[model samples]
Target: MQDILGHLQRLGMSGYEAKAYVALVAAGRPVNGYEVAKRSGVPRSTVYETLGKLVARGAAFEVRGAADATDYRPLPPEALLDRMRREFDGSVDALRDALPAVAGAPEGHLIHNLKDGGALLDRAEDVVAGARRGLVLSVWPQEMARLDGPVRAAAGRGAEVSVMAFGDLGDLGGPRGGERIYEHRYSAPEAVLADLGYRLLVVVGDRREAVVGGFGGDGSAWGIYTADPAVALMAAEYVRQDIALQILAERVGGDELNRLFATDPGLLRLLGRR
Candidate 1:
């Protein structure tokens, strides 16, 4: 009884109206104001007014009663529910059509924050999937596993795809069949992650949009996505520099790279590894 009253109130009924309507429904017949007040525990003072509101809302119907006293009967539950559903859907459709014109155009560069791993990845996947001209990405192996499909799809559609990947992503079968893939060799991915306190993931699409995210060791994640040209270009350059670093590492060799990492404090600060 309490549950039914609560549900009715949520559907836009006042407390008295909900109780009175429930009383009418439970009575399963036309009931007078006095009887409704008694069954529903609504104050007799407001019961008639409440019943009138229900009648106005079509949740109840007024009927003639003995001695000209008015009585009310509940609309059948199925009919009442179906009517409400249709009304609600109609309102939603109208808003969907009308609200956008009122919202107007984009004011400026847009940046949005994604507060969890799922949302961050979802936005990254959207950026990758929507890329038309090119893609630049820097991904930890963990995130790359999730993004592999979108990356391949983008590349297969003729988008120039470049990936600067940390950690060995075994089974991707080297070179990813054609996309520019740069495997970082300066330090272990774990060491870099430990120094930074999170796994960083970046995706830049068409040099026009980017998603930069941090997936942390403590199960927390956060990220930002933007169409801001400056930010996107910066992220793209970050990946490009990484690809260039990989090329330099190959030419300089691991021994020389390790010597620089150990000897140069500035290099340690920049690389976030030692």
Candidate 2:
């Protein structure tokens, strides 16, 4: 019952209206205002008013008998949901067609913090899907797995896609086929994970926007999404540097790369310890 009320509330029903509708739906027959008030625990004073609203919204209909009394029956759940879906889609289409011309232009530089992993990845996917020219990303396998489809779609549309993957790409579900779907470079995940104690993910799209975030061992995830050109440039450069280092590592070999890391105090400090 509580879950039904929650869903109804999300669909724009007031608490009283949701309660009244649920009561009617559960009754499975026409119910008078007083009976609805008793069954739904709504106040008698508001029961009729709330039912009237439900009828106005097309979620309920009034039934009149020989006497002057009125009763209400809720629309079937499936029918109600279908109606809501059609109305919602129509509103979205209308707004999509009308809004851009009337809406004021946006100001430069926007940044938003996404405090959940799902939201962060959703924004990342949107960024990738909207990319026109190119995308540079530094990601863990888990995030890459979630974003693979959007990334591939972008690349298929002629966007250049480059990926610097931490950990084994195979572990994160391996390579996605198709030309230029992923131009990838491998990096030891532990190299950064050991220092940060978390997994980092970054995406820069079309050199215009970026999202950078990390997931921690404690199951917390966070990200900053921004359209600030400077921030996007920095993120793009970070991925480029990682790609460059991978190239250098390939040329010098792993043993020589290890030696360089051992001898370089700056690089060692950056890695969190010597």
Query: TM-score: which candidate is best?
Result: 2
Clashing pairs in 2: none
TM-score of each: 0.58, 0.68
Q: What is candidate 1's lDDT per residue for 1-274, written digit by digit as tens?
A: 8898888778778999888888888998899999999999999998888888989999999899999978889999999889888988898899989999799688998999998999999999999998989999999878988899889888889999999888877765254644788778866787888889998999999999999999999999999999999999999999898789789889999789778887899998877875
Worst 10-residue lDDT window, candidate 2: 177-186
Model 2's C-alpha root-mean-square deviation from the true structure amounts to 5.2
Q: Cα lDDT for residue 255, model 1?
A: 88
Instruction: After the best TM-score superposition of candidate 2, give how far the Cα of residue 113 lies from its true spot, in angstroms.
Output: 4.4
Number of backbone clashes in candidate 2: 0
